[model samples]
Target: MAGKRCLKGVDIMKLRFLGACREVGRSALLLDDNVMLDYGIKMGEPPEYPVNGVRPEVVLLSHCHIDHSGLLPNLMDIEPEVFMTPPTADLANLLLKDSLKIAESTGVNAPYDAGDLHTFMYKTKTVDYRIKFQTHGYNVEFYDAGHIPGAACTHVTSKSGESLLYTGDINTSDTRLVSGAVEFPNADYLAIESTYFSKEHIPRKETEETFIESLKSTLDIGGNVIIPAFAIGRTQELLMLLDAYGIRPYVDGMGKEAYEIMMKHPSYLRNPTHLKRAFDNAISVKSSRRDDVPLESSVIVTTSGMLNGGPSMYYLNKLYDDPKSKMMLTGYQVEGTNGRMAMDTGIIENNGVLQQLRLKLEQYDFSAHAGDKELKAIVKDFCDRGTKAVFTMHGDNTEGFATWIEEEIGVQAYAPVIGEKFDLH
Candidate 1:
């Protein structure tokens, strides 16, 4: 809680990293001991949450992804006012409810219950991008981050005039769903995600074409194509991509509900009309009709993305022994997840029994986060705006990314560890 004095003798702002420092998951940061950003949980055998104990006056979420917003229900006892975009609130509620069901089925105790969810939702206050508001002594604004339907970058200014910007998950390159993140007012302190700092994404068009070709190849051989995608963002993006390529896909799982949610907020999307068309072109899979899905020469899109649980497992189980069938992964497979194991070892455990996969497995880079080159461009833009200090987080190699940022951008950069604190002047 120590602060440094600024040039005008005003106390500088303080930052504490609660989670998502050296690795990607459970992103949380405490600002000035009163306001918090992104209380989340890492997905694994036993989920991991952000450090607890200190209760903030308010919590500001950057997005609704599980890694960024999963643990919000845990804070319901404190009843802190939560702020996020309207879409984020809705999406987060969906994800949290699903998490509770998953935990119940697996015989694990969820940190919070239905009552907590109700309380969390009751205290939530939705805000649109660029609208300035007051929370405690800080002036806060949200900026579109272009990572998902309602993802945002949070910018805050202390009463003393010091400013800090937290770039939640960001994508600087435009996708079929939304435009890339736009430039915003610069700040003295910047916290950026480095999820793909050391990697470069393939050209978007090239990746799309390749994926479509693979899908067509599988279907041509009378093999079913199973695409396991995240329910929210990736699912919609894949639907649009398939539609644009003139392919009809069967949509299943929570993605169908998520799509309906997105349709409600047309302003947050790049092309609402196009999305609508994509939705119309895709066949929505109904639970009653799931048994009727064509077993061959068809494409199916389902969720849980990681193969942990969901309709994807049902589809995978049916296609496991079909050598001609293809399983396409459309997002990052975090370490220790069922998806990663399937990708790396071609083995999946079901009902405590190990099953070998004989289907063709492939992964495509349809990630929503920006890649290394795009991230560098973002850093360069902020540096040009006189950002003095940068804190890197939400990646596997934050330390490496921080070093590169400091040496290449000529600005002080650090990859903080969990529970570390810093005084910004």
Candidate 2:
């Protein structure tokens, strides 16, 4: 690890890249060695955690996704005062508890136990969007990030008058679930995610139209359609879409719980009434209905979006050999996940064995992250407001994205690697 450096006459603070450098998960960053932003873990066979051993006085969380909040419980020993939105706290509790359950059932030693979860919850403080507060002598505020319910972008101003904005996981595109991220706060420095720097999604209306057309075609042929989606935001969006088109899907898995949690905090949603109507009209699949859902020509929306381990696997096991059935994926499939495997080789691990799937597979771009154009617009907007430096992270093409920002946007940019520290004066 490199040591922090300072110029003799300049007031300087250090920003350390603890994780999420040119990668998608395990996000962590340390500011001034005493304040942390998003300590999380990557999900895979054994899972990966953020760099360990640095203690912070406070943590500013951006969202509730596992990649942004998974490893938070591990900080219980330090007992950092954590701040997040009310809905994020509830959703994080749901996800963290499920992670612990999955670990116990698989016999994998979890990084933190129930005791750690309790401590994490005890140290958590909820704050609303646009609300300004003080922590460790620095002024802080939250902006709605438009990724999921309670997701936020954190802006912090040091006592010395330097300002920094950390966008945890942002979406500048509006979906049925939430609106685009709010206008960014003007700051001297910006740390933003580059998740979709190399990709641009098809327009939302056109994508939905195509999705509905395909669904109708599959259902018209008497084939059961399985839509695998992430429980948090994607599932809810699909529900509203399907409801609008008069298709009632059989809802399953953790999405039910996630929906219930989001409903408790309607202020974070774009249209809570529409979501509630969709939920009411949808059929909730119980344990007894699992074996029968695939028997009929039905539309099923289930979780473990990557087709990893969830109710999705059970449906896959029953329909993998059926040529008439279909499985539509609605999220980004990280490398090494079952979704990627299915997309690449038409094979997936089912019931502890490799199986070739005969069911037709398709992927739709329902991502909550901003696309290449939106990213450029965000950078330009920040630059127009006098942002002098940009630190890009959380994507495979972070280095290239940084280069583009420097060359095209005329700003100083860096894609810091894990464990690297930079001085901001």
Candidate 3:
């Protein structure tokens, strides 16, 4: 894909890497005049770990994933102009509010509170995809990222006509939830995330088949299938696949609890499919409720994805000891998180209590992130016009992506360290 770019006498517009340059989590992309594509925090690490100054010129959110959207609260210091797509804005509010609650519940004194959440919401303005908007002399356009509902990859063009595309987190070929990253006709700089690059992709059918087989095996022995999924995108995607693949279990309260939280918004949902499912399956069960059905036929999908919070702990505590019960993780469990600890060794104590739970576990790539082959396809398209340079970040797999991008895509792609800056004119 070459011969599509038309950059003539374009000057101005700079790119900066604030965080997640080569790391998998904590994504922050700073632009000229402090407009950020995402102001986020790292997983497991303190969201505001360094206590450094990151006053973005302004902030634009791609989606509501905490890693991509968590740092908006700190903008209270910068007080930058914040723009989000309508649904992304809505979901971000829910996510950030809940995040504050989670932090406080865990007795971690968070910087921002409910008052800051309200103020942040008031500052957040919604922008539409494919439509151009102006901010501090930059023309920014949005495209459906397809990684999550309301997620978008942004195309920012300087007043001087220099353009850069920041793919917050992209999925080139997953359609279970969102479609896929949109192709751009013009882009000078492509800042892409390479979370799963260098790994051979498992065919979608194979992934689904693996999930079903695991479920069937657990069900056969009367065990519960506990899926530790992130509450936002991956959880919904897994639920849809389970329903599509004919493994509908009596969904528990986690989805319902999340939706009730969503209903506080002026609009219902960015995508209403799973919202309706959660509404339909709003069943409440006491902690001591007895299980009449065997564990094999039951399914439980809980959030925090990495066993960090929400109903995941409850499911693990309840079913961990049962031989028929199984835990299948469908997302990346950050290192040192509860999910990683469990996967590393099938043991996790129930919170502060010393009582432990154990279960046979199998993990799959149920979580959708752009992998190596997918990143190559996007870069191939972006650099078709002979892009000036390619910037790769937002991954733990740095060297692997660097090699593939140079060899396969044939572009000058590099993953910069945190706080790095580039002057492209």
Candidate 4:
């Protein structure tokens, strides 16, 4: 095969990194020369590029999250058909539509407008999770990534003989709403996400207990807690966790919005009945109007997790003036986001960046991505020979992930560069 002119005559799968190669956000990968698995996240991005012209044969969304699905709107004239699992489709619809409105009202233009969003939404073909289906030249299937509801680690095989797996923000732990990522058996190249590779996260149970107890203590002190969460995965899990309190606490309007998204799922929830019963008994739906101070009576879960823009910001605006109100941070707050602003100033840290900031804040790391040990166990089955190459992406905490994988597995792991292309057999 090596001696012959196979590369020119025969179809060979080549991977070109579109985004998410070294840093977090903007994840796009060109698979098999034409099929675009994801069209999102171009870091420190330019307004134009050459690969932008490559008409995508198909755009597969791993989940409805903004980072993975963000590029769909930016495509030029190519109206590539978009495909996602049913739950992802539902969540994407809501998220994109909401994102569209934000961009419009803020006078911030994005790739696609609301009309294009619906255009793609109407054309979206929703595949059921775990089922093998055919699209274009690829036979594809999905396994729950446990990162978000309907999120998946996609497996695709091209007709010309290339098979691969892409972990789209995977979580190895079993959580309230979804199952862990499925094991991969074969691939010429496995594109893995390394968002948390640098450091190990605290145990899930310990984090959850701390988050809840903090809220309970705040509530007991006659304080209201506002937890800004990504509407899809984090909100669902938090609802289930909060319901563990037997007294049946109140959920603000933001929680109601996420609950509507949950209702769109195909099957029964991955959460227990206690949460469902709590949803029935507790939970308050907030109004579109601001200025309602929800004090001492509720827990509000809203999104635009970083608090860049969303209903959560309005909620915060409503509560910022109230002394009895507290904000609980359940996930990572990016450097420049409002959540980070509130958190840094609230704590009496003498650090210059946060010294002048203001507000009462508390946080816990409850991210859904897999930690070190869990990631090792997930890839344990692939210890056998015959694997070709391993490339890691979507990690900022490059902390020691690359070295760890290389030393432990005896495989040469390389973190590729964004926008760089690689030749795969």
Candidate 5:
């Protein structure tokens, strides 16, 4: 449904929410019917995607995370002109290729193929942050999102003069790898992520101390530690943290390649020296060397944070029967994932067989998203600048966040459902 004009002679800008409404994955949004923002997918046993058959004239990506930019390869058939930062382009390519390999190994038909990935790369154009450009009669710009390397918050001005901002997986808190997101130009319509709304993150220093202490305790007891992290942002950040705390970990999976890519682009990181130190201190694990990983008094950091695939599973299979060993999950585990199931119950399924885990399991909150206070600050910052409308998304509690924004922040806020459309003027 469209909103009525509150002012005379103002043009209407229609928005359609294709995904990431009250959920935290598959984020797709269409503006003015021609431009699309962030077409991604939800990772699970049976992966889910954004609404199909969207043939936008142009696509603006926010980051490389699967939940924000996973479905871009599928759009090769449409041949949409895609724009992202250079780092994002590199990371997305790495991740999509891995995704295709995983799909093939699992006997699942992927939506796109190697040819599609090549086409997607061919149509991609890299842009730097804060630089405005014209695309299909719209003025477009990107701001640093601070969630991951080259993540961005997108702003667009329609041909008819309406303005909109779409924040994709934002993190307004400084991390070891990246700085916090800062102010952007105000717009009439705002779409922001609410990943951590109603929750506050522990202070970074304290969290680091706790994590280090836990690792030390496990090592002291002659137990090996396994840290499952996302291949992109979280793995790199954890490596820095481990280096800072004087711990050397065995790095495995796509995270190893991801760090190599990150090293090539020092401009995208907060401190290249720290990242370099981490890489220097860590031991890189080759796939053929998996069986040689020391079973005692060692720390292993691997990818597939949700434990759905990757080398994390290989390590877990080897260590699951060791009572003294411990597994530390370093990221959010979506429901129905092996990681989540293991956390809730000491059981994990392998090859269609469920088995009880003897090793200890722990979870730490090392999310890259902004917390409640940060989300509120972002909303109030834009609200004070005369943002007329707000839409909360990319979380389970989107409706609650929208209500809070409307009632507490004193702005017109909405929690749109999937496939919902609105006309903003």
Candidate 6:
């Protein structure tokens, strides 16, 4: 959809919700039909993509999570100018290539080929936080999102002085990896994720302690502890946490490469040395060593965080019948994913067969996104700063969050549906 011109000889700032309006995944937002923020794909059986047909002149990517940056290469035909932080660029490259490989191995049709990925990479420009840049008649700045390495909340303004602040994904509390997000930038409109709008996290320290206790108990019982983690942020955070607790786990899957990629961009890390030490202490699992991982009472960190695939599945297949063993899931499991299915039914479909798991299972809140209170604080901060409107999205209960913003924050709030467009004025 294209932006419409007003009769007053002014360009109207139109906002379109192409995806991630009321649910998580495939998060694409079009601003005046020229700028796109976060073109990502939702992971599932066939995988879901954002609504097609808009060729954004500029794409402001917020982070490197697959749900946020998965489909960037699909726009290679337009050769859209893409902007992101340095680490985000590198990590997105890693993930996009990995996504293609996974798709081919699973016989799923990939949306873009290697040629698209190469073209997309060539067009990507890495920008630092707080630096002002212009693209397609819009001024843009990046603010640290604290969600992961190189994750950013974007501030954008048009030549006409109309502006918007889009919180791609944010975390307000410090984690082992990144610091809390920077303060909000005042703008006319605010668009933010509400992933944990109705949920508050257990204090981070307490949650870590509980996780450690469970892990130790599982190991003391003469069983291996398998931790399924996301490759980018969660895996590194878990490694740091485990290092602090004097545990050297066997790390496997793409997380190994992600750790290496992150090391090249040390400025994004809270403590590069600490992460280095953690990685040095942990064992890297190679294909030849995969069979050796489950022989002892050790902690193994692997990926496909949702247990959809990766070495985590291999370990589960090996030890599923062992009641003493435990599989500790360490991230948000999207609905229809193997992790969610296993959590809810104790059965996960793997390799085209359904298998009941006898191993002890548990989920830990190691999310990179903000919690309930933090999310509200983000909304409130923008509202207090005179943001004219707030748009809640990227969660299941966004409508409730929007209602809260109207009732408590006294700002006009909207929960947009896919394909809905609004004149921001």
Give stretches of model 5 more than 4 Å off.
Answer: 1-9
lDDT, candidate 5, residue 139?
96
- TM-score-superior candidate, 2 or 4: 2
TM-score of each: 0.96, 0.97, 0.88, 0.86, 0.97, 0.97
Q: List the residue pairs that clash in candidate 2.
A: none
TM-score result, candidate 5: 0.97
Model 6 over residues 275-389: C-alpha lDDT tens digits? 9999999999996789876556889999989988888888888888889989999888888799989999999888888989999999999888899999998888887888888
lDDT of 5 by residue, 118-235 (tens): 9988999999999999899999999999999899999999988889999998888899999989868889889999889999999888888998998899899999999999999999
The residue pairs that clash in candidate 5, if any, are none
Over 1-425, each residue of candidate 4 has an lDDT whose tens digit, in order, gives 01111122234777777777666777888886667877664322222222365677788789877778876866634677778888778777777677677668767666787668767877788887778888886888887777877888888888877777888888877777666765555765577888777568888789877877777876777767778777777776777777765544445434455567666663635654544565676655555433454456567776656666566666665566566667777777655455665665553222122232233677788888988677666554444534455668887754356667678787656676656666654
Clashing pairs in 4: 26-41, 194-395, 198-399, 253-286
Expressed as tens digits, the lDDT of each residue in 251-348 for candidate 3 is: 44345444444444423234456545644553344445536424556787666687776767777777777777788888887776777777776766
Q: Name the regions of candidate 3 deviating beyond 4 angstroms.
A: 1-10, 45-51, 252-254, 257-296, 353-357
- What's the residue-level lDDT of 373 in candidate 1? 94
What lDDT does the true structure give each of the candidates? 0.90, 0.90, 0.71, 0.68, 0.89, 0.89
